[model samples]
Target: MDFSTPIMIIGLVAVMLALRVPVGFTLLISGTLGFAMSRGLDSTLQTLGARFYDIGSGYSLSAVPLFLLMGHMAIASGVTDDMFKAARTFVGHIKGSLVLATTFAAVGFAACSGSTTSTTAIFGKVALPEMMRVGVDRRLAAGCIATVGTLAGMIPPSVVLLVYGIIAQESIPRLFIAGIVPGLLTALAFGIMIYVRVMRKPELAPALPPSTRAEKIDAVKSVWAAILLAFIVIGGIYLGVFTPTEAGAMGAAGAFLIALFRGRVTIDAMKNVFIETSKTTSVIFIIMVGALIFTSYLAVSGTSGAVSAWIVGLEVNPGVLVILYLVFMLILGLFIDPISVMFLTVPIFLPPLVRLGLDPIWIGILVTKSLEIGLITPPIGLNAFVLKSVSPGFSFKEIYGGIWWFLQVELIVLAILFSFPELTTWLPDLMYGG
Candidate 1:
């Protein structure tokens, strides 16, 4: 097959993306056209007929909607608010405590939700006002909220990591297990950054009055539902007591119970949650189907293999090659959504890296971390946009200004993960035992 065929298809995808066409449709059109070109219209038509059902019926993919439902239910139950309150109550006495609380709350919410936008939007509404009220610098408050939301990409039940596992054909449970340490470390790094920043510039954030022991205890008690739900969902998976799908189901049910017990589960609220879940799930499946179709075309046309062989023939150092691919993703991430970045690059770059005997699991984590940085990067920072939408007063300059500090911390964490593959791999290896 002529290399031009795949090149033309890629160009078409780029053009469509530049035109702001939806990612799902871009992949669908490009894949269908490319497949038809190489395999004939009849063969392409047959595959299209089967593709939807084949992807839609995937048992593993069912977990996507279930986990999404759990996240939406958690939002409806005011879990995000409780998490922020609890963290603030415990640590409010410290300098930059509100900023610290926001980070802690984000980590807690990440345990429950996988959608970064959802996390950003909720925290923007819930935490931003509180931080502003406490005289925290608007830029710092907004920046921290925007940056921490990316945690959902690395944390357990993360839809991004789940999609990565599906596309890369790695173990989902292992991916989830692998994310735990890096995710926490990222949060810790953010906490440290916040502490140092507030210490150096005291006006950026004001310390809240310390809570009494009883108040702290009460705050902790208030979030018992969130703690229990996270334990049952994440803890169950860690202990091997539940499959990812079963865990998603239990988490969704647990979230609903939390809402129901809290009297937050009105009929209308339930309807809205289900509708939102269906919408998100549908978009994800379309992208997945389209990506699979596109990758199938690459396979049939020998593009993936050809590219892999070409890269291997170069005999470059494996470390440099990995860094190059990561740098490419970081740049692409500046323009595209994280999901699109994964769908576009993984099929092309992952093959050569895997051929080099690098671990796909570790690569998955690194790719995820790169994409997480993209969410807060300049020009097209999606999380920053989300935060701005929720917060009309903060200009892009202020948001990006605050983001710069946390971005440094993120880069440091990314470097650490890259330098020590074991940081990303050890837990999974220990949990599943290589």
Candidate 2:
């Protein structure tokens, strides 16, 4: 293999992505080609087989399916209705509070959903219609729904964070704990943004009459199961009562119980949940295995080393390098899905980043943050596409337009995290020790 092999593989993958090929296929083919060229066909096949076997049999990977099932079951249990009701009851009377309620509800749902697409879809069905019926601006409502859903990627039980922990070899529970403050900060920032938008326009969202005392009490009662489940699952992990994988199992079991209590469970529903979970987990795991193979190819070809050395020899400040790294991710996010971006870049960029003496956990959070922002960004924002599909009332332009302010709010939160690494690290350190 020559120096150009890695560049050729990257170019081929980029072309495949441009042609709209699935990311998993793109990585698999490109990596296999590179691996064969660098290490011979027999060795490449053997390495690929070994990598697949290791990833397939890993206990840690079991958490992927469990967490995914927990999200699907949470949706099946109709927790979104309770979440939205409780949030609306608390904040519905304030200006622009419908959107505010949606944001609050998103934070709660994020705990269980751990998926931006599912969270957005659920709210599209649950809250978007209510906001529309209440005469809220469709653009504002749809935009908030789309953007706020990205919170699921940042909150505890986040699949993105979990995958990051696995790839970066960081502690999963610490990653979960580290996300708490940033996730809440994101929700609060979104609420503040909505308030300012409505306060100035006074018509983007119409305030509703306050919930009666009884209504508030009822709402609280309705959401107690969800709250308890989250506390048990996430809190258990934080307290070291269980490993992250065990936490996922507890969460899945709890979601099933909630579905039973809500009378939402049925033979068909369980089958469907299982089917969906299987499909999702399979897709994620396949992509992951492909990433592992591709990364190994890169390693065997000395591509990572060459790239890392090239980056180091740039001789820029470490801070500037970090900025550039983030900027590249943000730009790449405009074109690629989060999972694809993760598989493609983390192996290449992260080794170099850690080589700079930056912390892996912090880089993981930063990468996750960039991916979260990408989900709401223009041109191929998956959450935005999912929103449009679920709520056809808003045009793509309208939905994208509504997202800018929230995007700005997210960027502000990202900047704060960027400026003060302590913000992302504090909780983890306090909980798990440095």
Candidate 3:
């Protein structure tokens, strides 16, 4: 097979993406055509049948839907609302309280909800109005909601981290553990940015009446169950009491029970939860299957090996090489969705970096963080667009304007992760003795 064949297939995928084809179909169609051309139709057909079954039947992949179900159940249970209220009660008297509350609330919510768009959409509805009612600046409010939602991509139970673990064949539990510090640090950095901005401008966020002692206690009471559930899920994984899939099942069940106890789980809500889960799960699985097929074609065509060798032969500093790879992903992320970028690049990039003696777990976290930045980036910023859709009053300009501050904070966090791999590795190392 010609090396150019794989390059051509990648070009074809890009062209299809540019034409706005769904990502799964683009990968599927391109992989099918490229594999057939390189390895004959009979072989391609056999491979396709095997790839779909193998990818779908993987035990690890089962965690995806379970985690997603947990998120939907949390949403239905009004756990997110309680989280926001609790955060507000604590921070309401501070400058930029609403924005700070949203950031803190996002940290709690991100533990349960792994999907960034879902978090953004929910907050756009839940927090946006409260901020608006309190005379928060539209740009700041919209930007804060959109940017903070990316926390879901970083924190525990994150679907992005889970997918990276599966693809890179790393420990899912370790990846989840590794994310905690960086995720929290990112949240804290955003909070500081909000505080400073509101301090300088004073018009961006107005203070709310301070909560009374009873009100503060009540706020904590409202979210204690949800907090305990999160602790159990994360702690179980960290202690090796449950595998990621089992932990996901426990979390989902806990979420459902939370909803049930709250009387939030009506027949209609249950139906919606399952339907949404199926839809998200199907899309993710299809994309994975398609990416598998495409990557298999690249492997057979020797594209991955050839590219890895060429990259390694350059003798570039490992740090510079990693930075270049991240920059490439960031550029791709500005247009392509994060998952698609992961599927398209990870196969080609991981080998060379590992050869350079870089840690795959650290690399995974950096890649995930880069993708998180992509969510709020311009033009095709999916999170920003989701925020805009739910917030009809704000234009893309206003949303992106507010996002600019958070973007700098994201880059600083990314740099910190890169400079000190220990930040990403410490907890996971402590837990697993790595």
- TM-score on alpha carbons, each prediction: 0.98, 0.98, 0.98
Q: What are the Cα lDDT values of the candidates?
A: 0.90, 0.88, 0.91
Clashing pairs in 3: none
For candidate 1, the 10 contiguous residues with the lowest summed lDDT are 425-434
Best by lDDT: 3
lDDT of 2 by residue, 233-312 (tens): 88888888889899999999999999998899899999999999999988898898888888888888888888888887
Q: Compose the digit string of candidate 1's lDDT tens values, residues 1-434.
A: 57998999999999998999989889999999999988999999888878887887888888889999999999998899999999999888898889999999899999999889899999999999999888999889989999999999999999998888888889898999899999999999999989998999989999999899998888888798888899888878877888899999999999988898999989999999999999998888888788878888888899888988898888689989989988988888887778878987798888788988899999999999999898899988889999999999999999999999999999999999999999998888767344
User: What lDDT score is found at residue 402 in candidate 2?
Assistant: 89
Which residues of candidate 1, in runs, are more than 4 Å off?
432-434
RMSD value for candidate 2:
1.2
Deviation from truth (RMSD, Å), model 1: 1.1
Model 3 weakest 10-residue run by lDDT: 425-434
lDDT, model 3, position 194:
92
Off by over 4 Å in 2: 432-434
Minimum summed lDDT over a 10-residue window in model 2 is located at: 425-434
lDDT ranking, best first: 3, 1, 2
The lDDT, on a scale of 0 to 1, for candidate 1 is 0.90
